[model samples]
Target: MHFTAEQRLDGGVLERTFTLGEIPGILWTPASTSAPVPLILLGHPPLGLRTMYPRLVDRARRAAADGFAAATIELPGSGDRPRWAAAEQARADLRRAVAAGGPVDDHVVDALVLPLVEKSVPEWQAALDALLSLPEIGGPVGYSGGVISIGIRLAVVEPRISAAVLFAGSLVPAVLFEEARRVTVPLHVLLQWDDEGNDRRAALDLFDAFGSEEKTLHATMGGHTGVPQFAGESAARFLARHLK
Candidate 1:
């Protein structure tokens, strides 16, 4: 891993941009301290880092203020990375189905999300390896935000993540429901009750499927991107309860 840039943000947070192999990523650390801080992996949609920067930085800063280090890596076929033709086609199909105002076909959801889960989970694991090697970042780790499916996969496969805050803002393919049953870490799931892009019933079912002995589903009344500030504070408290 190689860092390409570094800057200081308000509140004594240090922000650095880096690349691991071909994947671009960003890391934010709180003010210098003698002890290494617990890390939060800030998960986001495949919406390219440039498009998602404002929100990602905001979340990172919050984590910093809460005495944690945060980091995020671009997903496969997203940001400045090379694109996949099959995924592109799957996206087009999904759009067409949504525009038609009919139920999205099972095949379309599988095509679009399954491959993404298959490719991106390993990349996130690799990023965790590099981030943990840094002097300023340490474990036990927490993962916050989504694609919710990716978070589910990570929770099941990446044992280093002690807790997770998953946003139910995207459609989860059926296969991941089984994986959800394998997630044994504590989870805080956020759901936007009026999300236009997600299936509310499926989101609830997914939450019910989690095998974790401790899991909370925090649902709020809003559309996607309308999560209240207090909701984030609640999530931070949940992470602190476990990661700290």
Candidate 2:
């Protein structure tokens, strides 16, 4: 992995854009730190990072100000990468099924999500390894994102991630709940209670399935993109508690 660009921000934070093979990402680090700092992995929503630029910047800046390093990588088929046709087809099919009020088949759900999990987990793990290898980063990492399933997979398999702040925005593919049962890290989940596209029942079920004894569900009223400012503050505190 190599940093392609670097800029020095106010208060000595280092802003960098880098790539590890096919994966492209941006990183924020506090400047002039003598020791390695905590790191938080950020996951983007379906709209991609460009559409959510403010949110990503806010979270990354907050993490950096809180003495943590934060980074966000482009998920499969996002960024400038050519979109994966199979995943795109599956998503289109699922949308049509949803619009028609028809039941989506289990196999179809698996097809839409499993390959993403298969590809994303290792990429995140690789990114983590590369990020941690840098002199400015250290242990007790955290994961934060609206990509709920990718968060679940990493929480279950990545031993380096000590905690996660998850946004429960999507209807989880059923099979992922089983994987949720294996997630042992502390979690702070944010749920917008009135989100139109979310399955409240499924989000609750997924939360209940978490294996971590110290997990929280912070539900507030809003749409999918309307998470309250206080909810973010609460998640930041959770990250500090476990990651600091």
Candidate 3:
């Protein structure tokens, strides 16, 4: 029951690393553990920096206090890891689009985008599987991501997952939406009003494609980041309803 905290952004948030078997992840959790709890796995945007966002850490910490364990994961090649030019190109394209700019003209960006997407999915799936296997996590699983939202969708469709929460991301290659239609678990999607990459319409289309009997969609004012502000309460409700 011991932990360490790395203060960041003038103490607004702290990056907490937790040991999961041999694999360690930077996460935010409650200081005290009174019960076995559900978990929220945060899938981050494809940022080159490893610094954990203060708002995300705050949201995760709050979720843990509310009887859920929340953790944000740093994808491979992101944050404290060596960067690849290909990855950087892909990230730049996303940043440009977010600024209301046109698509990146770099061919390298286009070439690396889908490969990175595919690579990250399996890594996240393995991370979730390992987390669920832990004895301390007794409740269902949920996820939220900006650029990585589609990865969460791919992970949740697996039989092991009970429920999922997605933010500002979508299934890609267009065909995955068809696969999403077959998922039986309850899914809640949070959409942003002016999401540059995956806008509201895209979220609506995915929701319609889900075809889940228990799916729900909600909207918020802030763009991608706004969705996680509700991570504590909104996810709690979904996990309670579905995890049981």
Candidate 4:
């Protein structure tokens, strides 16, 4: 139950890591705590490439300072101690496959796609379940990620997450959209204006399908990576509004 400090921040940021089920994450919490607070389950990009993404780490620290328990989870196949062999290479291969055929053209990439998806989903679900069980977290939680954000949308249906922040990820295969409709929580999707690969229109279609009246769509100037900084303040505001 003890966590190892991973980083130090200004204004009393304390970083630690916790093993939740089979997954582990670096958590940033404020030094001063008076009571139990809501939690944010931050899903980092695939392959742990963004483990050192400064904006993301800063956001977690700010969330802690703002009085929410925030943690950045290194997904099943994405941490330094990944469960899979050559995890980054495997992820890169899949990305190449997706890019070759376009996001919606699953027929061209299902051979490589299915197994990777299956391998990663369970670990995400376990992380979500563990976060909800923590005394510091309330019923509703906020999720954010790039491509892995799609996986989070798929896994979060049953537990009923309160609010979700999806960045540059899509709900493809139509069936995934059906699952997304089951999420009654507020969903804020951020995408680039000219994202040719992921197709901003696809994200719009998914937003149209969302069941919540509180759903929002914001378009920024840059591609995938641009979202974290563009939407950082908005993300903080959204979490503040809904996580409480």
Candidate 5:
């Protein structure tokens, strides 16, 4: 990992930008700590990291206040990374389907999300490998954020992840249901009840599919981006219980 920039935010939260090979990423931690802190991998939509920086840093600052470090990596085909033709095509197809006012085909959903899940999960694991190597970051990692499928896959396959907070606002391919059943880590899922972009039943079904014996769903009335601040505080509390 090559750190390109570093700054200390208010409240002693240290933010650093870095690159792991081609993947650009950001890490945030308390500037002064006597011992290593647990890490939270902040997952986000395919939107560029720059676009998501404000909210990402907010979560990081909260994690820092709660005595944890937070880090996030750019996803494949996102940010300043090279464009992916196949993913682009899949997105085009999805847009057309949504605009046509028809239920998105399973194949289309598969095309759009599965490959992302396949490609991004390993990248996240790699980031975890690098982030945990830092003396200030320790084990029992928690994952929190969107692109719920990626969170699901990582929870199932990444043993280092002890807990997760998932946002149920994305299309999930049917194939991932089986994978979801394999996820045994504790989970806290946020659902926007009135989200136009999400399938409420499908999100509920996905939550039901998770194999974790401990999982909580916090459903609130709002659009996709309208998650309340209190809801975020609740998620932080959940992560603190498991990761701290």
Candidate 6:
């Protein structure tokens, strides 16, 4: 990661902007963190990181306050990375299906998700690589995001991420359910019961696929944007237990 800009936020959170070959990312560290702290990789909605800016900032800030270094990079097709010619088409297809109140087909799912998986997993790993090399970051990595599929992938393949907090609000492909079985790390999954556009069955199925003996499912009553503030506090406590 090549850092291009940086500034300190309120509460002594150091925010640094970097680019992994045009992929913009931010690294956040708390001022009180004098020693190496656990790292967290934050995943955002597919629309882009910008759409989730408020929650992202809140999450990052809360994590930093709890003495964890939180970070997030732009997802493929969302940031500085050039979009594939078919990217919009894939999105439109999924949108149409959702608008029709029908399930997105396997082909559409493959088109929409395969590219993200192919491109994003490596980028996140790269960000982890670069961040882990810093003296201020190390050990017991955690991941938090609503992009639950990506979290599942990372939990399966990235052994360094010791714990994760996943937001269950998407339709994951069946193959990913298989990959979910490979994840043995501790997980804390949050499911907003009435979240719009969320496939509750899929979320439950995906949660069931996690092989981790330590996985916990947090179900709350709310919509996508209606998640209660207390949920965040509970999640922070969970991360603190395992990460701090």
lDDT by residue (tens digit), candidate 4, 37-134: 67776765554635555766777877886788776666555555546655455456656766677444454334334455566566656666766666
Per-candidate TM equals 0.97, 0.94, 0.73, 0.80, 0.98, 0.95
Model 5 local distance difference test score? 0.92
Candidate with better lDDT, 1 vs 3: 1
Query: lDDT at 194 for candidate 5?
Result: 92
In model 6, where do residues sit more than 4 Å from their true spots? none
**lDDT tens readout by residue for model 2, 1-244:** 9899999877778889898897778999877677999999988775666776678878888898889999988778876767999989988988887788776766667777788888988999999999999988997899998678889988888899899999884556776878899898889999989987677887888889989999999999989888889999999999999887
- lDDT string, candidate 1, 22-64, tens digits: 8999999987757999999999988999999999999998888
Give the Cα-based TM-score of candidate 6 against the true structure: 0.95
Angstrom error of the Cα, residue 178, model 4: value is 2.4
Best candidate, lDDT: 5
lDDT of each: 0.91, 0.85, 0.59, 0.63, 0.92, 0.84
Candidate 3 stretches with Cα past 4 Å from truth are: 1-24, 27-31, 93-113, 226-232
lDDT of 5 by residue, 154-210 (tens): 988889999999998548887787789999999999999998888899889899989
Rank list by TM-score: 5, 1, 6, 2, 4, 3
Among all windows of 10 consecutive residues in model 4, the one with the lowest summed lDDT is: 104-113
lDDT of 3 by residue, 13-130 (tens): 3345654433346654445555666777776565532455665666565565566666655565676655677767666665665576564343534444466666666666776676
Model 4 vs truth, CA RMSD: 3.4
C-alpha lDDT of residue 139 in model 4: 45
Per-residue CA lDDT of candidate 6, range 1-244, in tens? 7999999998889989888777888888988776899988888876666776677889989998888989998888885567776767988898999899987898887788777887788888988998999988987899887577788888887888888898885667778878889999888888899987788887898888899999899889988777688988888888899987
**Range of the 10 consecutive residues with the lowest summed lDDT in candidate 2:** 45-54
Question: What lDDT is obtained when candidate 6 is compared to the true structure?
Answer: 0.84
Clashing pairs in 4: none
Residue ranges of candidate 5 with Cα displaced over 4 Å = none
